[model samples]
Target: MGINAHFELGLGGFSLDAGFSAPGRGVTALFGRSGSGKSTLLRCIAGLERAPVGRLEVNGEVWQESGRGRFLPTHRRPIGYVFQEPGLFPHLSVQRNLEFGWKRIDRSRRRVAMDQAVELLGLGRLLGRAPGGLSGGERQRVAIARALLSSPELLLMDEPLAALDLASKAEILPYLERLHGELAIPVLYVSHAPDEVARLADHVVLLQEGRVIHQGGLNEALTRLDLPLARDPEAAAVVEVRVAEHDERYQLTYLDFPGGRFTISRRALTPGQRLRLRIHAQDVSVTLNRPGETSILNVFPARLREMAELNGSKLLLRLEVGDAILLARITRKSADHLGLRPGQPLFAQTKALALLN
Candidate 1:
């Protein structure tokens, strides 16, 4: 099951023509700059902005077909939308606000239970409080819980953390990860922040000037040098690894992926715990031979898969390390000195700058 959509909308000054299909489960991030039609495409899927020509199907169910003259109104669509703001009812208590949505659906149709939503968002203690009394993170968590209580078939979040401060965003990110882990419903997450997309997205759609520049798995999309994401200096490859061991004395943890092992500062995670790591291209360096006595703990053998000239002075190299792929950004002079070429064996050194749970 998956989401299939095609939309073409022409407004006064902007026009949007895009199509994409993503898996039915996990999150698919709509990524681009501010005016790139991320939100507009989302609205078209939700029926908020009627496209002159469109076709949409969710989990094999047709929601819209302009040729057939069939379009489901926003209210009829089984979706829960979370905007940038919480938008909780000021007059109601937190519990009541959450119940407002749960009560609307028939008991037989309810797929998400109240207790499940509460537990997933950690809203047990704040259930009795008012929306005004909650912090930005807490309020957003409640908004998410309320949305879940509605038993939506699809969850649409349009920059749910955009309005929150940095601290608040950090506070709520773990809960979002929990949601990603526990929910079976598909989520369409809209955001311009690359870090957020790398942290949460399973699939990615890169929109530029109302067109989809790329659409694929998060790792493949981010590491493609021809795409906008890879052009950014901070572009990275995301990998999933498991905690293999912990060194309490040194305060370090060893993470194992199919390629090799990564040693980072010890987290609260237990052995066998799964984690996500974002390794920036700039943090990786290529070497012809494994060097002895190096401070960098992560040095693995990789084969050069592709190399693209990013500019006159710099180049981007894509390397295959076992089952995983990594991108390294190095100067053209260095590539020339090393005689880098596709299918060449080399060692990649990663400093492990950023690792997320």
Candidate 2:
């Protein structure tokens, strides 16, 4: 249930003397700033970068051990890798390119069939088209499908959406989510984007200077103000919510969390569906008392759990509402003027940027 590794490699002027263990299932993100050895670590795991004195075991299987002289080649290892680019063959049609992996992998050992891969990645339409004819998002989907078709035990994605535009990323994210949900393979996803990590990863491994600084549930790591990621102006908390009601008249979807109901901009979500919502700290405002007339539709009475000075005059407040934890960033003057303290009751107000189902 763990991927343990001890790497020792040199990359030009920088050397990677790092190691970390990722979970068996779910998306384990390799998160860090650029040039933090995230990709190098992944490449080592994939056997692309050989470690002079390294050991790697996935799900208790020893894939590599430098001391013992045991090392499995990249193709022999049950791994599917998706790089930043689609890496689709321009010469071949999408279907042919997908079949290339199937041909290389043992025919008897393949568990994921091509039909399922095509269906899962929505590659049915693009299969007949050439790579040049398909869009960036489409090419990425084809790449994922190709990897899945190989029936790999582990999936490694190295900033798969980094090369794409916002629209392309938006187009590909849901497919990635579906892949995570449907497939049984353990995924090691590399990314520097906090938003991407928040939306996708169930487990997070924060990398700093070629070492794992923090590793835990995504919600916990993301909400910690001590981490560098928390300094982001877009810093937020993720909440799991279930669909409560959908009002066609008002064009709003009501989602029920542990503490309150949130109305988000969604139309296709059905009742009983579940979704994770990102609520930014800056979007939240604290009020000493509930106001009578406010434009904010979502307001929950919360008790301040902790408060800490952020920048010179900014303060970060952690509040608990029932089982849900919320974050609010306020000015130190506002915190003092409102007499905010631990266990003080306050209202956390937010607009309809909520997650729906």
Candidate 3:
């Protein structure tokens, strides 16, 4: 399924003029920093905010058409939205809060079972509890379950983890991934976190000043040297890998990427398990010669393809490894010291980067 929209709206002193389409499956992250109009664009799609000259179509269904005078009401749209806050009713129990949407529909149209939603979100234990009694993460889980139970054809999550702390964010991330992997519904996830985007998104839509700057697969858009986010100190290339083996002696899990194997800090990762690894640009170094003695376990031969200035003194390099590309950021001094240039053969060392599985 795909979503296409062209919106022109004025809110407060700023005006929004933007358009983009989301991928059918996996998370299509609306990525940008603050004041980029990401939230406003989401609201337009959700039918909460309307534009006089706007058009929106999801999964081949036209929710809005400016010229045709067609517009679908928010309640009538087959969409589920989870905002930054859980927004649960304090007086209602978690179970009752989840069931609020159920009463709006006829019994025959409700396809989502309460038991399935509870199990999917691990909300069975919290059913009897009030919203005030639950933690931030628990409340978010309940919110997700409630949204799922609404039987939406498309799910729109606008910074769902933004209100939580680091630990709380970590707690809810796995459940989000599970929902994506197991469910048939497509998700449009909005966030500024590149790490989260890299971890969860199969496709991406990068917006800036209410305009679409980039839209494609996450790897292609993220690895591009032109985008501002690619110049971040924490900029990294995300690779989907599979578990190859486990070393009992070292207590390490071996994962296979396109070029070679990588040993990461994971355990009980059975063979054939799919995983993602974020190889940060700063953590990667290019070596002209292979070192004999080193603690680094990952060193793959790659050819330098492109180089761009991260700043005046620092440079970012794009290296090719089979069909996949890896990013490395280094100083101009180091580049000149190592005589690095495009088409030069180099060994990339990256063993300290975080591995999320």
User: What tens-digit string does per-residue lDDT give for candidate 3 at 1-65?
Assistant: 67788899998877889898777667888999888888998899999998988999888999999
Rank list by TM-score = 1, 3, 2
In Å, residue 175's CA in model 3 sits off its true spot by 0.6
Q: Which 10 consecutive residues of model 1 have the lowest summed lDDT?
A: 348-357
Per-model TM-score, in order, reads 0.98, 0.94, 0.96
The best candidate by TM-score is 1
lDDT of each: 0.93, 0.87, 0.87
Query: Can you write out model 1's per-residue Cα lDDT over 9-114, one digit (the tens) per residue?
Result: 9988999999999999999999999999999999999999999899999999999999999999999999999999999998899999999999999999998999
Model 2, span 1-357: residue lDDT tens: 778888998878877888777788889998999988899999999999998979999999999999999999987889999998888889999989999989887879898998989888888778789999988999999998898888888899999999999999999998999987888788999999998998889888888878778888887788777876676787888888888998888887898998989877656877998888888889888998997887778999888988878888999988787788778889999998998889889988876364511
Could you give the candidate ranking by lDDT, starting with the highest?
1, 3, 2
Model 2 steric clash pairs: 274-357, 275-357
Misplaced by over 4 Å in model 1 are: none
